[model samples]
Target: MKHKRSLLALPYVGWMALFVVAPIVMVVVYAFTTAGFEPTASNFTGMGTYVSIFARSFQLALIATVICLLIGYPISYVMAKEGPGFQRVATVLIMLPMWVNFLLRTYSWMAILENNGLLNQLFDAIGLFDLINGLFGTDLTYFRMIRTQGAVVLGMVYNYLPFMILPIYSVILKLDRSLLEAAQDLGANSAYVFRRVIFPLSLPGVLSGVTMVFVPSVSTFAISRLLGGGTHMMLGDLIEQQFLGGAYNPHLGSAIALVMMLIVIVCMWVMNRFGQGEEQAVVL
Candidate 1:
């Protein structure tokens, strides 16, 4: 019976081989081969130009990840402590933005943040910009809010925030209230209880949320492209331009893809280490 049940997984294994394994093999081959199918190091030899792009990408993603954590953790905590009706309404509201297509959401931001768009118009109507300009005695009318690095980071946080919230919320909801009560009975204050009890148990969820938000934030091209106005180039943009842009260099594109994969793998390893620490804390 065990042997028969094991055989049931053969189709899934075969699917992975065909879809996952084969594509990775092709990418590896392309990364190392020239257009004529000959081995060449030219693809990697040209990585000097991409160093700044990689650094900028990492910086932007890190900013977005940290912002998500700071914003999401508190919201998740509140949601977890709420009644069923409140949680239901809050969950729907939190996830409502995701019902729209991601590209559409991004485009909507473009409209909101554009120089002549709703935000600037609202500022003009409210006389806030005029007040600032008058106070400073400058002729400034509209600040350049869109097409900047900050805009890109804002887009990332907005889009990926729910990924952070959901995991932490799930973990917080499962927390043993009895432990919290016990700590309080022992004269522990709210801050002390959170510091000693609640936070340690929530590490797993924090790690999971970091993984979910960071991985996608690091590789995202669309947000950077649309929000940064193509001035900010990340690893994803480099890979995209290599393959689909004017260059048409599959070898270089594959190399960039491999590098992105390695970065994500490193992030996962770091998250795993944190998870192990969480387990140790639980044991203690």
Candidate 2:
């Protein structure tokens, strides 16, 4: 039986070795080597020039993650507390945008947020711009909503908000009802019960949602490119430029990727630890 089980696992092991392990190994090798295949650390050393890009990526990602949490948590909690029919309809609505292609969804946002796009056209039709100009005594045509950092963050939020919602919803929906009843029996009010019992138990889901949202937001290129119009270049775009753009430097790209991976790993570790601590405190 043991030998048979080992044989059964061979294909899975081989798959990981070929796909996951091999790519990671290649990235590590390229990250530590020069274009000539000679070992060198210059690639990492040169990263000083892109500090602002890294900062902006993390900042925008953090903002988007926070927005998703603020918006998703309440919705998730409500869904968890609602009837089956309501939950079903809410779930479908939340997931409807995801059924469309990601690029198409982003393109739709472009049409909505562009200077002379649908939003501005609506504003013009409604005399909103005219009202603002009249009050301010200034001539105004359209608001510059696209091609800014705010637009990039908005794209990230729209694209990744569902990721934050589903995890938290699943977790909240699965909470033990007996515990909530016990808290109530102990004279805990709704707000107290949530803060003391519900929120603590939901830490794992929150952490998962944060990880899901933050990772992609931090590494996104297309959203920043299309929405930000190359003005707010992120780490993902910077890495792409090194390998595929005019820069043509795979070594530097690999180094940046490796550093980003390490940073994400550390962040996840910290979040997990914090979640565990919160859970432990709740249990006590």
Candidate 3:
């Protein structure tokens, strides 16, 4: 039976090696070697010049992740409490935008936020721009919303918010009703019940959502490109320039990729440690 089980897993193991392990190995090899196939530390040494890019990416991703958490946690809580039909509809609504292509969704934001786009036109039609100028005694015609860091963060939040919601919702739905009831029976109020019971048990899901949202937000290039209009460069943009853009330095791109992979691993470890600590506290 053990041999049969191992046989059954061979296909999955082979798939991982071919599609996942092999690619990672190739990237590591490229990261450490030069175009002449000689090992060198220059690729990583070059990263020192682009420290600001990594900082900006992490900052924007952090902001977006926080925004998603603030907006999504309440939505997830409400969804968890709703009837099955309502929950289904709410979930579908949350995920509806994901059906469209990611690039298309980002492009749509560009159309909305550009200087001469629908947003400005609507502001003009409603005299909002004039009102703002009148109130402030300035001659501002538009807000210059696109091609900026804020726009990139907005795109990141819009795209990744659903990821934050879904995991928390799943965890909330599986919460032990008896535990909540026991808290209530012990004279715990609504706020107290949630603070003591509900929130504690949902740490795993919160961590999961944070990982899902932060990882993608930190690594995204398309949203930053379309919404930021190449004005701001994130880590993804830097990596892309090295590999696909005029720079055409695959070794440097791989080095950046490896660095990011390490950062992500460290983040996961920290979150795991934090969650375990919280779990122990809750148990006590």
C-alpha TM-scores of all predictions:
0.95, 0.97, 0.98
Superposition error at 37 for model 1 (Å): 1.7
Worst 10 residues of 3 by lDDT: 275-284
For model 2, the superposed segments whose C-alpha errors exceed 4 Å read 281-284
**Model 2 pairs whose backbones collide:** none
The TM-score, computed over Cα atoms with residue i paired to residue i, of candidate 1 is 0.95
lDDT of candidate 2 over 121-166, digit per residue (tens): 9999999989999999989999999999999999999999999999
Provide the lDDT at 49 for model 1: 85
Alpha-carbon lDDT, every model: 0.90, 0.94, 0.93
Q: Identify the candidate with maximal lDDT.
A: 2
Residue-pair clash count for candidate 1: 0
The superposed Cα distance between candidate 1 and the true structure at residue 144, in angstroms, equals: 0.7
* Cα lDDT of model 3 by residue, 1-284, tens digit: 99999999999999999999999999999999999979999999878888998999999999999999999999999999999999999999999999998888988899999999999999999999889888989998888999999999999999999999999999999999999999999999999999989998988889999999999999999988889888899989989998889999999999999999999899889989989898878767
Residue 75 of model 3: what lDDT? 96
Per-prediction tally of clashes: 0, 0, 0
Worst 10 residues of 1 by lDDT: 274-283
